[model samples]
Target: MRTALNLRLFLAAVIATAVALVATAVVLNFLFRLYFEDRLRDELETYLIQLSGNVAVTDSGEVEVGPLADPRFNNPLSGYYWQIEVAGADPVLSPSFWGAPMALERPEQPGVIRVQDINIGTEEPLAVAHWVILTGQDAAQRSLHLAVALDRTDLDVSVAGFRLNSTLWLAVLGAFLLIASAVQIRLGLRPLEKVRSEVNRVSRSPAGRLSDDYPTEVLPLVEEVNQLLDTNAATLERVRAGAGNLAHGLKTPLTILHGVERKLRKAGQDLLADELQTEIASIEHIVERELARHRDSGQSRQVCEVAPVVRRLSDALSQQPGSEQIRWSVEVDERLRAPFDEFDLTELVGNLLDNAMKWTDGRIVVRGALSGTVASLTVCDDGPGLSDAGHEIVLGRGRKADPERSGTGLGLSIADEMAQAHGCALTLDRSDMGGLSVMLAWEQAEAAPR
Candidate 1:
């Protein structure tokens, strides 16, 4: 499964802590068991020494037993026991054994100590043995073996309690360590979160750049990003300068062609003069359209207020020769702004409004509104509208819906280009004013109305 860096690190640390704690608990429990076994052997050795000091053998081979200091040795099957055996006599057993005998092993040689684990009937016990030689009356010698043993219950209980407590504490300690690791991971990655937010703001703001307030490890990356943005800005400026130079260079040839047309008319070649005039007009239209696009690219980006641009274009179109006979009206929110440069907005509105003034018979209306982050502009006229197919053809460059209309086909095409430059949708439909309606819709860049 996929996992984030912080979560993966946390899980790794927690698993490692859990495994280490578990291993520590196991090792400590094992060591405690070994220590407890050694303690049982030591206690058995002390009992062995006590029994040997008080034991005796008579000349007639009778075994004599004595009282021991520990009261546990006197109680039958009290989990404590002792036994003594001579060369060929019956074995002596502690009172703790009751009538049951312990199967304690003898030492191989005199004064040699032996330790083992054996079962007294069904119970397991630790057994330690010592061998010696005893002298009786007349200098006769007899062999003696002494041993002590106890059950494993007390040792088991002690080791079990130590393991339980150690595990509990270690587990609690592991939990705290995991929590600390989580906190450390969060603190370490906080700077990265800040960088992500700043990068988003840069994309949304035209003049925004990455901030330098970052850790040493991240500072180099931030500097590189800022450099890239600066380089891009310089490249766009050079491109715009080149386009402007080319446009001015072409205008000179167009001016010379106009002079030739006038000279041809003065030479009495009227037919050739008219043809050159039409060609010059066509070339001028192409130049104007290209210049409009160039301006769109060169203009500085800003929030273009819709109301002022619409009113200014409406007033300018009203002054045109044919437009004086028609009424012009504009309705737009004063606070509404589009995410476009001012010159681009002017070109888009001027082209559409100019076309409306040329076609409308009585009245022309321009309306604008803001809906959420989207802005919509509509221009309508009371003249005859186009069919669906005709509207489609009008959107194409150099294609006029009605050739009889006294205008070049560049108007609607230029407006369409501007809409596409701003990443907008331009569509045509019949208006309620019993005429053609053109609408433009685009997303706004600003958060507020202004």
Candidate 2:
């Protein structure tokens, strides 16, 4: 199967955009988590400073702490706590711990806060910020350790919320990007589509060429295509000219051979003359077939009314010597058209009519009709019809139903070649008139004017 450029480009864009958005979401979530954790540690440090300021050492080496302002420190297992420790004295703890003391170590430097994560007998961990300070006068001074801790679950909840919201918004953004990418791809490929249309126009036109109204990126392609078309037209012209010249060159010799054959027959050399005549007829058939092929190849596709061509050929053929006794019938609509050059259509119809005139006992029929976009032309006669096998045999070059018939045996072959050249189908079948029926059908290029 052929891959479409639009589909391939859209798929690539979809993959790239999806990958980029996922990476963005991951990175943003990671960075946000770190920032949220940092902010949480700063808040814990602030609480630690408040707790240290509330601590004091007694003259008898006893530790004392004032009630902290935050209510979470007073509630049992509230995931928030404060503790104060003095050397040679019992530590003062926040009621929020519920008698579960945290094994926090003292900070190395006094008055410097240090933060760490520790499990607090709960499903989530705690973020602890601790500091050491000196309390009391010089002789009575005591090193006191102050600490404030908050549950890690709070940070987890905040980060989780941010991640959810960010993902939702980012997904929406990715959707927009995908739609925009699809539109961009379609717009970007429009010029190529136009080029294809112009090429089709050229094929259907006699002297058509591609236009210069294209993007700079596609201009070179357009120029190359135009050059190729010019080269092809030139090549076909040369081929037709050569074929015509060769035909003219051989005509005189064939004519001379005919004269020689007649003289040999008059001299009673019947066998030798007959062989020469056969050779000459074979050469003539080859020349005629090649000429017809060359002519059909050079012609451009066109929409020509089928009725007029059939009528004209029928009128001319009906006036021939043998067609006088035959009853002619033409059933064709005036609007019926086929995708074929007028010259080629004339030659094709002429061959069928001429062949019918040769074999018809008394009646011949020609039909032309348009059904939807397809147009058909059929010529039938009332004569001895061939069997199904003979239908295929007569379509071959130099093949005829009767060898004794005075013809080059190329009429049906040439007609079939013309039909195929225009992408048409030509078939032979048993006619209702008791003879061969040759039908040519092709898709019409455009509707003919009423």
Candidate 3:
């Protein structure tokens, strides 16, 4: 199946949300890590400043460690350490170092601060160092380097936790947004769905029209469709009116010609009179064909129940002279519908039944049933069925199996035109009754090929 528009839009929204959330999580985590690194540097710099002020050179020319402010500096292997180095004396280390010598990079100049990573054999820490020139008792300047270190394990743990929490919350937010997008898409397009349903209804019923109660976005479209329908209806009406007027105007002249033919026959000029009658009959056939074409155009899109229409046509046909003698059997379900206008259905069936009545000796049957997307109909008669070549001839305009019949031979041709108009296939073949069988199969109007 083709994907629905709303579903495609919703999927795009979901994918976009997921990508945005992932990007947001990555950015937030990165920014937080930078902030944490700055905080670590500031803490290390503060410790380094305090250590510089506390350093001293004794009168014995030996370096001595003073009482430190931070308790972690006094603990063994506490992961926070301070070390002091002098240019001409041994380096002094804090108790927290546990005698593990940290390789620290010296600062570039005096009173200048530097931050670097120091890795002992077992652990890595961030170190901040500063170099200072101190004046001893002899007024000699001694270069002192003070450095403070802190382990990065705690910062890493904090960042990992923040990242995990951010991902989970962002995933939840994305799901909520997907649900909201689905609802919004459906609500936004509900007006178009309404218009579709109403348009379908109008196609099935000629009297139906789309209402103006639509969203502003769809109002213009609905108005244009309604106006087009009105224009088509008016145009069809005018054409049919002209056809009807033409038929009426020709009928009087044909009647006068028939009178002239009758007079010639009474006056014993049968050969010329018969030739004139044949020509007049051909003219009448053309008029009937034109009228049938106009009648079919305005009735193609209507929907009607098959059984009622068949019964109504059968009842009307039975009132005619030869129709009463035939055994009429109709087998149609009441619910079996045909996608054809009621009048069109009557005309299509009437032509077939009228021809059957003309040729049948006793029995005629009309059967209708729907299967899948097709409506199947069969009209059978107990008459001398035509050969393959005759079938083609009878379906042609003004061709009859028997010239003795009163018709102008336009019945099947008109029926063929009606079938084509409604996207139906009509066929003639030998029947079970040892006679002619006419079959019509049409798809549902929506599925019909235009």
> Against the correct fold, how does model 2 do in TM-score?
0.87
Residue pairs in candidate 3 whose N, alpha carbon or C atoms collide under 3 angstroms: none
Model 1, residue 220: C-alpha shift (Å): 2.0
- Candidate ranking under TM-score, highest first, comes to 2, 3, 1
Best by lDDT: 2
What is the per-residue lDDT of model 2 for residues 84-166, given as tens digits with 9 covering 90 to 100? 77766567788887756778877778878889998865555889898888876778777888888898887888889999999
Q: How many residue pairs clash per model?
A: 1, 0, 0
Q: Write down the worst ten-residue block by lDDT for model 3.
A: 441-450
Which parts of model 1 have CA positions greater than 4 angstroms off? Answer: 1-3, 31-68, 85-91, 98-145, 250-383, 403-426, 436-450
lDDT of 3 by residue, 173-287 (tens): 9989999999999998899899989988898887778999998889999999999889877887898789889989998999999899889999999998989888887898888
* Candidate 1 residue-wise lDDT, 177-289, digit = tens: 98999999898787778778877666545457899899999899889988877876576567668767876888799789878987998999989987987777677667767
lDDT of each: 0.78, 0.84, 0.82
Candidates 1 and 2 compared: the better one by lDDT is: 2
lDDT of 1: 0.78
